[model samples]
Target: MPPHVLAATRALNWLELVTETMRTALEALAAAAPEWLIAHVDEEWFERYARRADDYRLPDGDTARTAFAVTVGRDGIALLQAL
Candidate 1:
């Protein structure tokens, strides 16, 4: 498989794990903040770059392709140890 595909697959797998583990909590969050569940991306930019576009740019120059968005509350943090 291509590198991008592999990366996406890994991300999706991790997403599945997260959603499964926190189904109840996620459901409540979805009810309270539905917008948080929406995926973040620039449609126009995505049209040009497709999956090749980096969704986020780090201060250190690294880039990230986020499969989706998850907005935990202001003081909330979600961390995945391994995926």
Candidate 2:
């Protein structure tokens, strides 16, 4: 597997765990950051990135490819997983 694939998988797994354990996406962000809110990403932006990723396929070229965007509201903090 590509290095980025492994990283993406890890991020996805973490997100799943957060969502599962926290119940609400908002809750997950709060649990992880205690002061933030996060929600589903904008569909248009996500799809645009997905298209680019399919053509370029640069491992870890962009954040979206590594993990689905979680719209961390003003309350949330940026959580970047170790790459």
Candidate 3:
């Protein structure tokens, strides 16, 4: 049997809404500085991009990915390839 990779597309903001851990972090960011990405995240790699910031809230418009999360933290985006 092979490991399964469940490709789930989500808006970058959606990650902060739907995922509890993310919400906590992002909410703090929103409260403290509504214009910057928060700590607990590797902002160096993951870019915070939005077409309209608020308008790009729909997950349906995200690019399709044939990958899945590993230890999805606010720090990284890991896709399982072969393990």
Candidate 4:
């Protein structure tokens, strides 16, 4: 396959992985921290998160991907700390 085709395939695979991981994380979060999710996470927030996860794309480059991961990690930590 051409380079562009290969790249696109890889991106699609990454997106699928991210989507599944997000779904699993959401399920675990709901089960493990139902009270926290209920108090802090509104319905709108859940809808927005679901949409984003369903349509998520991998960041364009290594630096962007790293930044995205770091931001997510920080956000998760902040949420946990708020509990």
Q: Highest TM-score: which candidate?
A: 4
Backbone Cα, N, C clashes tallied per candidate: 0, 3, 0, 0
lDDT digits (tens) for residues 1-83 of candidate 3? 33332333243444544334434545556677655544344454233322223433333333421121122332333211210
TM-score of decoy 1: 0.33
> After TM-score superposition, what is the CA distance of residue 64 in candidate 1 from its true location, in Å?
14
TM-score of 2: 0.31
Superior candidate under lDDT, 1 versus 2: 2
Pairs that clash in candidate 4: none
TM-score for candidate 3, residues paired by index: 0.28
Shift in Å, residue 69, candidate 3: 2.7
For each candidate in turn, give its C-alpha RMSD to the true structure in angstroms: 11.3, 10.5, 10.2, 5.0
Residues 12-64, model 2: lDDT tens digits = 55544443332344334446764333243333422323222232343343475
Q: Runs in model 4 with CA error above 4 Å?
A: 48-83
Candidates 1 and 3 compared by lDDT, better number: 1
Better of 2 and 3 by lDDT: 2
- Tens digit of per-residue lDDT, candidate 4, span 3-74: 998986676566546545654666678899878777875454365346444324546765776576565555
Overall lDDT per candidate, in order of appearance: 0.37, 0.40, 0.37, 0.60
Error of 4 at 28 (Å): 0.4
The parts of candidate 3 lying over 4 Å away from their true place are 1-18, 38-68, 74-83
Cα error, candidate 4, residue 1 (Å): 1.4
